[model samples]
Target: MLGIKVELIDKIGMHSSDTAMIFLEDVKVPASHIIGEEGMGFTYQMLQFQEERLWAGAAAVVPFYKIIRDTAEYCGQRKAFGQPVLSNQSVYFRLAELATEVELLRSLLHKATAQYCMGHNVTKMASMVKLKAGRLAREIPDACLQYWGGMGFTSDVLVSRFYRDFRILSIGGGADEVMLSIIAKEMNILPSKKK
Candidate 1:
């Protein structure tokens, strides 16, 4: 499922632009194109982030599952002291835990999307999903690659590639701290006192 690139001339996937605006842009294009109902661009952009973030989370799910599988295969084949590396429970279960985390993140993303589509306010949900996905993207492949020892450091292994590639999820979708701040603002958790 991963590494399959589609040939579509769509800017949404290219520059992380939202599909909603792309459609809107197509219908109404002018030399001076300022979008939304005057000062509502912030709200619209937040909504767009929800969709883009959910798509990002969905894109990561399958590749993460495959990481566990590939790691298991590597452990099974790799030997140390004439015993298969997978004979160690820690190696296998750590990855199982990572897979569980990946699934949990996916569940949150799906739930957020469903709620948003049902006309519920999903700002908090979106922030949560983006935050978790960012943290997971950093930790999962990093931890999985560590399981491979020296091979994880080499370009020959897919784990190495995953390690190199998955780092962008946090910074690209929105930095992890940015999501936290947004969620806090949504929940009125940010400190404020009347002057």
Candidate 2:
């Protein structure tokens, strides 16, 4: 704890969950405090990231579903052109698509969890889940916010809050590019490096 300085980073998203930049200035950590064996930190962290990816993917399912429902409800009550905005073919159809996408992600997350519980390695499955979840986190909110119209841009609405919050899914656990690389490596499609 000594020589450690913590500063909260002011981020556009994830306001409730505070993110910080930690500075370690010549901190002395006892060997007993070290996690696992010496020189295995990288291995340990990599192993932890698999679980993190799965969690980030699975956790997003219900929240986005709620967002979709709420946005739909709002649109149904709100009128445009003398009819409910949701009555438009474009609005409801897109909402259906977003809902369906979340369902698919939920299925994938459940399958990955089952395999994980059975003591199977799920790096590929987790990566897939994470990648899809990250994309949807972006897509679903953006679409829903558009339906919210000017209100979506404001901080008052839940859609706006989620827009800020969930944007981290793609960048937090692993960037989309990193997830793709992991999937590619697992698929045997990534080119081998020249030795």
Candidate 3:
């Protein structure tokens, strides 16, 4: 495990300002808590972000897979017009397609994280993973909810909990827009762009 933990020092919109500060403050440690070299802290922190973001991206695939599978099961078990809802090709195929997308995104995130660990240029890869992960964070639950119809909206459903939990990925670690800015900066397309 890495020897660092990042806490957001700013929160606007949803949560309270004090909540953000509380996260920022965390708990102070003794001076001995420092590890390795003092000057290397930024580098270590950046690397930690890479690993953390990659894990956050890759982790989405499992619950996404389960959501699609369980939605399929629900559709299959529920009867419509004396036949199962899964009988409809549109519904089942779309669920399968989303599953395939989750797999592809997982692969991309893993490969990018590997490149990052190797000390290669990985800003584009990282941004791509972050962007895709955020999109999937929204897409997976929305799709699952659609499949469940009214039942998905209720708090009792397992899918509802996933819907709420996965939402933090985009804005929590770093907003999707923030990742885009990082990618743009790395690509020399922002202020650094030739004018």
> What are the C-alpha RMSDs, in order, of all predicted structures?
8.0, 1.3, 6.0
Instruction: Point to the candidate with the largest lDDT.
Output: 2
Instruction: Give the TM-scores of the predictions, in the order they appear.
Output: 0.75, 0.95, 0.76
Kindly report which residue stretches of model 2 are placed more than 4 angstroms away from their true locations once superposed: none
Question: Model 1: per-residue lDDT, tens digit, 127-193?
Answer: 7877787788778888888778898988798777767667777877588888888889998898786
Model 3, span 14-47: residue lDDT tens: 3433442222334656679979787898888877
Which is the better candidate, 1 or 2, if ranked by TM-score?
2
lDDT of 2 at 138: 95
In angstroms, give how far residue 60 of model 2 lies from its true place: 0.3
Q: Which of 1 and 2 is the better model by lDDT?
A: 2
| Candidate 3 colliding pairs | none
TM-score of candidate 1 to 2 decimals = 0.75
Better of 2 and 3 by TM-score: 2
In model 3, which runs have C-alpha deviations exceeding 4 angstroms?
Answer: 1-20, 23-30, 34-44, 191-195
The local lDDT score (0 to 100) that residue 194 gets in candidate 1 is: 83
